[model samples]
Target: MDALPTDPEPTDTRPTDAAPTDAVLDRAAGAVIGSAAGDALGAGYEFGPPLPDDARVGMVGGGTFAWAPGEWTDDTSMAVAVLRALAAGEPLDDDRTLDGVVDAWCGWAVDAKDVGNQTRAVLGGLAPRTAAAARRSARAFHDTYRRSGGNGSLMRTGPVALAYLGDGREGDLARAARAVSDLTHAEDDAGDACVLWSLAVRHAIRTGVADVRVGLPWLPATRRDPWAARIADAEVSRPRDFDRNGWVVEALQAAWSAITHGTTLVDVLERAVRGGRDTDTVAAIAGALVGARDGASAVPAAWRDVLHGWPGLDAAALTDLAARAVRR
Candidate 1:
């Protein structure tokens, strides 16, 4: 591979003490762009008609597409919410994080568009208290909802990983991922897998893409569990041929394996989409992780422009937020 050219020195007149490392900035940019592009591309096929393989390249959701070209679904919307909340420097406790998540949902709901059924149900039952009874009630409600195990939690978990990186807190990122996921998905397998994947993405961004060890620790626990183990074993044996029928376990494993095994952002996403179930959500998860690892430059340029119509925050804004989060 050719060496990347150095970025031109900043010419701004403002006095700045320092700038972020190129790798960090690149990761942030990749994460934001990759996520939006995936969301937009995936949105076109969201529980809808399929596209032929030849036309899949550079596809966006315009008139030819159903939901408007470049429009993101619940996946990116929820991710933006998490990123925004964490950018405000909130701590990662269940109560506080759940409140932030609910607040985000309410904000999106008030827009009166693009809300998912499962997410709406979970948010509708949320109460604004941290009392023991409230906690127990919330947990039970969330657990019941977890049975759905939709890819919703995994789709939105990227920001949590980016936000908590380098905080010197082992498993903190994973825990935060779980807290946000528990807002709508509290199943142990689903929630734990979401956290593990999020942490893996963060580790990939901070380290290089070669460190599969970043994901190994979390796998042991996942492997010990029957549901998670089945997914893991399947991914190890046949990553490219995994199933994806909104089964949380398979979806999680498929996304993780795609990132770990594939050589490029497109390869990972293609693997994810080909898994055949809940294709959009699976692609979204794989996209976010690969985006963080490879940086923005690695994503195809044409797809970035196609993601312009997505609901929720803009890609550049999210990148700026990630950069700011890193600086803080």
Candidate 2:
């Protein structure tokens, strides 16, 4: 396993002056709205073969999970839990915040139609349902079985970026992303993937351009070169080449490959979904960077009009929740 930073965000401030601008807020909200939208769009096609070039994709749900049309899956549902946890206004890595995230995830998992295998093992198997219990279980699972690098963590990592959108919070963003990912996916690679993807989303939100490499500095020195090579490969490849998109690394590559291949948010998400395998998750992952790059306006109104998921959130409510959470 690769070594990655696992520190918590040491410094924080509720600076009103450093609050997100309208544009930044729009991009932040876009990350959430677009993530759910893409999840719903891809829900119908999960685990299928690569789609034909001319195949039409939309939020027409119903797969192995039988999701409702325009309804998100565990990807966005877990993300909604993270967003709610962040809205508590504590540091992202705080025990209180992580515990609240665990609590929310447990609540949602109780009735969620679909939950990731790794996530359910850790969450449902815990005795007390505390963050501490969940982490210990997840860590032991990885240490014993050595196969916890699923895409589950990365799919929900986009909302962690919103917690540190204030100026000079890049380090906080990286640390928080890893810390949250560790709650369910303690494998080093899973944490590393979340750090890179979260920082990329934050960068796109700040700059309105999608560049996944912007977070290399936050990774451990030993793994930086390898991740760079992976990113380079993604730039020259198509999403369909990543056949094992359920793994964290391939999921990132597939999502980044999708991101690099398209000119717009919708196009990128479509490319991600059509790549097949873990279609909803790959598209949900791409949606974060693309949405942060393109802003909420880039998401088509028709998609947002129908997007719905866990906790009874619609696209508009999702935007509002993300806005409120980031402001915390």
Candidate number of the best lDDT: 2
lDDT tens digits by residue: candidate 2, 1-328: 4455555342323343376789988999989887888899999999999998679997788899898899999999999888877766667767877787888899889998888988998898567767788889898878888789999999998888987776668788888898889899998789889989998888788778788887887888888899999999999999899999999999999999999989888999999988998999999999988999899889999898889988988988888888888787
> Model 2 misses residue 134 by how many Å?
1.0
Query: Per-residue alpha-carbon lDDT of model 1 for 300-325, expressed as tens digits?
Result: 76665456533445556667777776
Q: All candidates' TM-scores? A: 0.78, 0.94
Ten-residue segment with the worst summed lDDT in candidate 1? 1-10
- How many collisions per candidate? 7, 0
Best by TM-score: 2
Range of the 10 consecutive residues with the lowest summed lDDT in candidate 2 = 8-17
In the predicted model 2, the residue pairs found to clash are none
